[model samples]
Target: MDIAIVGGGAAGFMAAITARRTNPSCKVTIFERAQKVLAKVEVTGGGRCNLTNSFAAISDLKQAYPRGYKLMKRLMMTFNHEDAYRWFEEHGVPLVTQDDDCVFPKAQDSHAVIDCLVQQAADLGVMVCCKSRLMDIRSMQDGRLELIFDNGTQRIFHRAIITTGGSPKGNNLQYLARLGHKIVPPIPSLFTFSIRDKAFCNLMGTVVDPVVMTIPGTKFRSKGALLVTHWGMSGPATLKLSSHAARMLAEQDYKSPIAISWTGERSRQEVEENILAMQIANPRKQLATLHPFGLPSRLWVYILSKLGLEAAKPWAEIGRKTFNRMIETLVNDQYTIMGKSAFREEFVTCGGVSLESINSKTLESKVCPNLFFAGEVLDIDAITGGFNLQAAWTTGFIAGSCVAE
Candidate 1:
């Protein structure tokens, strides 16, 4: 069987290797537009290549993906995180989990992971042809797939897999849509909002753990670590919220105001009660000198300043009105988002090939027989951590096994 996989990224390469491993006699070929494979893997996770998450259960793993959570749940039951780790371990690539459950190469080098995939592909007799841009794909009358390359080259294959990733590069989706597959409108995900507030100007390096972030027009809320950058707010919480609200944010022109609760564990009533207790405990002490709720003294002062509270005011001297205002600001701090910042080296997009046209179990297209899809190319995206890469591995493995069968 001749199988041609397009876009030699994580999913494409993995599928090629999996197909060859499942059937040694199968001719597996990967056509990468770039001269190198795993370009994204090299820069992912600051070059460490966060391989897979430590989450073992399919139920918990599905929560990481906002787009295809339900569909991925069924798929992950077949090839979950443990399966991925074992697959790499058996292939001579050992993985170590970080403190946050993100798995990476024990050597902490993305090239090591990339080398493992490349070497494994070679060992499995999978042919990787670089600089071969697939221009078009056509289904022949004899039930074979015909691929036309940019260099005026054409190849016929018994099966083809489209794993060209998202719209980060170009209009690769158009090529696939022309081949009769539905393509979802691509949108940016896992991005930070650019807030137009000076209070967060000097807070570029400040990190707030367990922050509750929410979109204004929606009831979506995420609690995780948040970082205040010079551009705006970022980190796990913001990125996760962005993934779930990518389409909503895009429709609003990225100008929606977001509400942030730094004290994620406490509600407005709880915060007010705590402040009242603090005032009673330290009646004679100045409010500025006593940092309540263990927040940074600087942040406490900033919040007081925003609430128009005098730093030198004694706890007893603070009026009920001012105290209520302070509590309100602390619980429901609002910031107008002006734009979006791609999380430096980390950018996970939310749109790709429509999942409805693909078989969730086999990663094969329902519209075209023998056509499979995997990785970021599908309309599936996850939050930060190792979720995105794990999706790739799972889908790739399934496609490989299905194609080989």
Candidate 2:
């Protein structure tokens, strides 16, 4: 049996590996358009290749995905984080989980993961044909599928798995759309908001506790540790907002007002009370020197400057209006986002082949039988950390197990 996997990414590779193991007699081949495979995995988590997360509960894991959460209910139940951990370790890749619950290979490098997957594929007789871009896919008269390649090569496979990752353009998925599937307009997710404010640029590298970030006039909001990047605000919180609000932000052309509360869980009144107490406790202390609310020294300094207050001004000198202004700046600061850029190249998309067109139970296309999908190719994406990779692995594993020889 000739089984063609039309991608060489994490999901495609996992599908290939699964198919080969499930039916060892079947001939499996990965058709990748790139010069090499696992390009995204090689760079995920800054080259550490965060393979999976340590979220033990399905409820916890289910919350991370912005789209396809309902569709993934069965998929996650089938092969979740625990199963992923055991699979890698059982396949000879030592794994480690950090306090943050991100899982990475013990070797502390993406190469370790790429090598492990490649070695396993090679051992299982799965051929990874790089630079073999699929130009078209058509059903044959004999119940087979014909894959036309850019290089003028063609192959007839008894079954096929479409694990092509998220495409930045809708035209890229036109071939699949022609196969009777609906394409959700793809938009960038898990990205950093581009704030043109000079103060934001100057505050690069500022890491703060979980901040409550929200898109004005939308139900989109998230709370997590935020990092001020050279480009813009990134880190877990911002990325989560981006993922969940991808469509809303895109509709606004990426230009929108954002509200952030430095005191993540605290209400504005709570922050105000805390600041008032600090003033009474340390009347002679300089505002910047006091670092109210335990904010980072640099961040506190910036907040003061942003409010047009002198850092050396004593707490006692803070006027009633200025005090209220300080409270607002700390708990209700607003910034206009001009644009966005990929959050490391791990940028995911909330849009893809609509989840309704596929069978969640088998990861197969209801529009076209024998044609399956996994990973970002489907309308499934999650926020930062290792959730995206976990989805890819789970879907790929399911597709691989279900595909016929």
Candidate 3:
């Protein structure tokens, strides 16, 4: 048996390794377009390599993905995050789960993760061909896959697994579409919003408690630790919102009307009452000195300044009208998102080969028998953290395990 895996990322490498393990008679080869294999793995998690999440159960793992949640739930029974973590540790890569539930090599270097996969493939006799860009694939009448590369090279294999990680462009998927499979037009996911607000941008690096960041006129919203970046808003909250609204915001051409509620549903009247009480309690304190509602001191100062309030002014001297304005700014702040920035560490595309066209059990293509799909190549994506990598591991393992059978 011969197996060919395309695009040597996390899923590609995993598929190659598992294919050899399941059936020793099968010869596996990885075709990577780049000069080096596992390039993304070398920089994931800021070089720590978040291999998989530490979800206690497969059911918990499914919730992390927005695109393939239901499908992944069924697939996780065969191979999941726990299995992935164990596989790594069993291969001489010491693992540690951080407070954030992300597993990484104890050395905290992504090269360690990359080296383990490369060396494992070498030991398993899996051939890796870098700079071999797969230009087209055809299902031969003899039940073989014929792959043609850009270098004018061609190979025929009994089975094939496409582990090409997400592409930001839809045209990049034309080769897969040629296989008569539906392509879910690829779009960006796990990105940061580029807000043009000076008050917030000036206070870069300020991380505040979770807030309800909603795209006005849509149901997209997320609440998590939001970091104020010089470019815009980032961190868990913004990244989650981006994944959920990947296509919707793209339709808007990346210019979004962003409305952020620091306090969720705490009515304006409630905020007003809190302000009145604070004024009475700390009459002598400066408005800037009094950081209310648990907002960062720097943020509070900026909000008050943006509201045309004097920092040195005593709370007692503040009038009801000014207090309401300040409350509104803090509770229901708004900004115009002029653009977006790709979050380089684990950036992903939300669209690819339609999941409906895939066989959920073996990851074999219903449209193209003996041809398998894995990782972001399928229309599967998840939010930030380690969910995306988990999907890659899951689909890759299932494809490699079942291709020979």
Candidate 4:
């Protein structure tokens, strides 16, 4: 048996490795368009490589996988995060799971993961062809795949797997579209929002835990740690909101209204009661000196200044109207999303080959038999953390394993 895996990303490498491991007699090759392979893996998790997540806090798979929860749930039964964690450690790379459930190499380096894959592929005798771009794939009458390359070369394989990850534009997936697979029209996911408010931007470097961010007029909301940056917001909360509302934000041309609950999911009445209690207990304390809800002093002062209230004024001096404004701003602060900023080089998208067009069990294309896909190339994406990489591993393993069979 011969297998051809396109693209040399995390998924591609995983697929190649698994294919060869599953059938030692089968031939496997990875064709990477770029001069180097695993470039994104080297920089993922700020170069530490967040390979997988423990998924301890995710009661619902949808919480982590916004787009392909059902597909991922089915695939996870075969090769889940726990399997990935064990696979790495058994393969000679020790991994550490952070308190946030993000699993990283114990060496705190991406090369550990990269080197492991490279060495494993070498030991398995899987051929890797860098600078070999796959321009097209044609199905032969004998059920083999003809892979045309940019270098004016072609090869025939019994099976072909596309792990090209996510394309930034729709046209990039035209090759797959021509094969009768429905393209979902790729759109950016896991991005940060850009706010033009100078006052809000001044709160850069301030991080609030358990913030609830929501998009108005939509059922899109996410709660996690939010970090205020000089440009805008770039943290788990903002990224999760971006992932959930990726298409919506793109529809508005990245300009949308956002509401943030600095107090997490506290209700309006609850916030009001807390403020009232604070006023009664600390009447003599200056508003600036005694912030409610244990909010950062800088944030409290900024809120007070934005509300046009004197920070040095006693808490008892706050009028009813000012108190209401305080409650609103604290629990339901509003901001304008001027644009979006990609989350570093780890650019993720929520659309690709639609799952409806593929066989969920083997990841084989119903439209194109013997052709498979894995990783972000499908309509699978997740919020920040290690879910994205985990999807790559699970789907890649399934594709590789089934292709070998």
Q: Which numbered prediction scores highest in lDDT against the true structure?
A: 4
lDDT of 1 by residue, 1-405 (tens): 999999899988888988998888999999999989889989989999998888742346445888988778898889888899998888788789987889999999998889999999998888889999988888888989999999999999999888887776437578778767787888888898898777776777788787899887787788889888887888889998888888888898988888988788697999999999999999999889987777777778888888877889899988888888888788888888899888756677778888888887888888788889989889899988888998899898889889988
Model 2 worst lDDT run, 10 consecutive residues = 55-64
Q: What TM-score would candidate 2 get against the native?
A: 0.96
Question: For every model shown, what is its TM-score relative to the native structure?
Answer: 0.96, 0.96, 0.94, 0.98
In order, candidate lDDTs are 0.86, 0.88, 0.86, 0.92
Cα lDDT for residue 183, candidate 2: 94
Residue pairs with clashing backbones, model 1 = none
Locate the minimum summed-lDDT window of 10 residues in model 4: 341-350
Model 2 agreement with the true structure over 1-405: per-residue lDDT tens digits: 889999999999899999998999999999899999999999998999888888753355446888888776778788888898999899889999998889999999999889988999999999989988898989877878899999998888899999989888888899989988999998888788888988777889899878999887878888889899877788888888888888888988999999999988898889989889989999998888888667899989888888888989989999999988888888879998889887765877778899889987998888787889999989899977788999999999999999954
Best by TM-score: 4
Task: After superposing candidate 3 on the true structure, give the runs of residues whose Cα lies further than 4 Å from its correct spot.
Answer: 56-63, 263-274
lDDT of 3 by residue, 1-405 (tens): 989999899999888888899899999999999999998988889988888888753355434787888889898888888888888889889989887777889999998889999999999999999999988998999899999999898899999999888887778889888888999998898899898877679989998876778888888877778899999899888998899888888898999888777765577788778888999999999988888778898988888888888889998998878877777776778898898898998788989999888888888898898999999989899988788888888888888888856
